[model samples]
Target chain A: MQISTEELPGGVTRVRLDGRMDIAGAQSVDLKMNIVAGSAHRLLIDLEKVEFLGSMGLRSIVIPARAVHSRGGKVVLFAPTPMVESVLKTSGIDALLPVHHSLDAAIAALE
Target chain B: MLGLLAASMPEALSAWPDPRLTLTSQLEDLALVLPWLQALADRYALTASTRFAIQLCLEEALSNIVRHGYRGRANQSITVECAPSPAGELVFTIEDHAPPFDPLAPSAADAAPTPQSIDELQPGGQGIRLMRRFSSRIAWEPTPSGNRLTLAFPLAR
Candidate 1:
């Protein structure tokens, strides 16, 4: 997986992930994601390009999201493909992280 | 890690003349699984949704075998066979030589209510749930050597 970060207005960090979020992909981004979780108080994970999501991929997201939560930070998922969204919902990660299809809605949630 | 093995039909599987890919029980071998599934999807003309479901279930099931069943050990054998059933469903059989464990059995993780918050969420145990939700049917049986898991999905015509 390829991860890139852009600073958005109002102190939110947009971390965009591109590639499959399967075992290898998740491992590739785990450390960087943790770093983002530690530093950013409001985080938006952009999933628009992620084509696949497996359980390990979910762990890669959940661990970081939990870290951000403990630090009083907010995290939201944005623009997952239909199959990826189904994986999120099936695992109930959608309920915890809150998935937003609209960029405006996702950024606003972090605010 | 050793190379993946191309398996011939075992006597038990003779009824289904399907392609088989066998790998060592290592997470790295998972990288090969998607391409294998993709080839099957292309050959069978499986719908995108069905393809996704099979991929999801295979990742979950195979990873579980590597992580939990084999305890992350390397060089142990794990075989996956893919075929279409007479009932118009695509079937996948995963056989692992690690131990006899039924992944489909109802457990505490299955019974636990969905966490309302991140703090309440458990770190693992979502793989089996994903398998159940994505596959049309799942069955597990104890093999003399270890365990076998079967996952089926209806072929979208």
Candidate 2:
């Protein structure tokens, strides 16, 4: 798994994730995601490139989102493929970490 | 780590072909099993939903074995077999030599909680829930040797 971070306008941080987010993949990004959540005010995760998402991957996202929410920040997800999105919904992560299809809408929601 | 040992399918599951792996009681071995599952998924042309279900179920089952079934043990072994039944159902049989434990039992506290609040949500407890939610059918048996778990996913569903 690979994660690249970009700072957008208005202090929103976008983290683009690529590859499968299974056990190994989640482990690779766990520490780094927490670190990014600490530094950013609002976080947007791009799951367009994530091919497979397991429960462990869900935890990777939830942990960081919890960290950000604890500090009054927000986090959202956008562009997850249908399979990845279904996994999110089945596990109830969709309610916790909202998902948006449009980039602009995601940015607006986070803002 | 996970070592892929070539093992023949058992008598009851002989109808399915040769996508089999034997893993050690190690968490990292799960990494090796994903590709094996992907190969089977592709060979059978499983749908996106089926593929995801297979991946999640395998991960959850194996992780449970590593974390709970073989807790604090070493050099234990788990065997996994994957194939499509003649009725076009994705089949997975996981056999473990750890203590006789039924992962599907209702008393397993590791089952994922439906999060009402962020404070109630946890990261690690979702595996068993995912396994139960995604697969069409699951059966567990505890034998004198150890335990056997059979999971089936409908191809059309």
Clashing residue pair totals per candidate (backbone < 3 A): 0, 0
Position B49, candidate 2: lDDT: 80
Model 2 Cα lDDT, one tens digit per residue, B89-146:
8789999988898777787735666787665668877777778778898889997889
lDDT for each residue of candidate 1 in B53-80, tens digit (9 for 90 to 100):
9988998898989999999889999999
Q: Which residue runs does candidate 1 get wrong by more than 4 Å?
A: B1-18, B108-113
Model 1 chain B: which ten-residue window has the lowest total lDDT? Answer: B1-10
Per-residue alpha-carbon lDDT of model 2 for A1-111, expressed as tens digits? 999999999889999999989889999999889899887879999999999888889989998888888889989999999878988887778888889999999999987
- Interface CA RMSD of each prediction in angstroms: 1.0, 1.3
Model 1 share of native interface contacts: 0.68
CA RMSD, predictions in order: 6.7, 6.5
lDDT of 1 by residue, A1-111 (tens): 899999999999999999989889999999999998889899999999999899888888889899989999999999999999999998888999989999999989987
Q: Give the lDDT of residue B59 in candidate 2.
A: 88
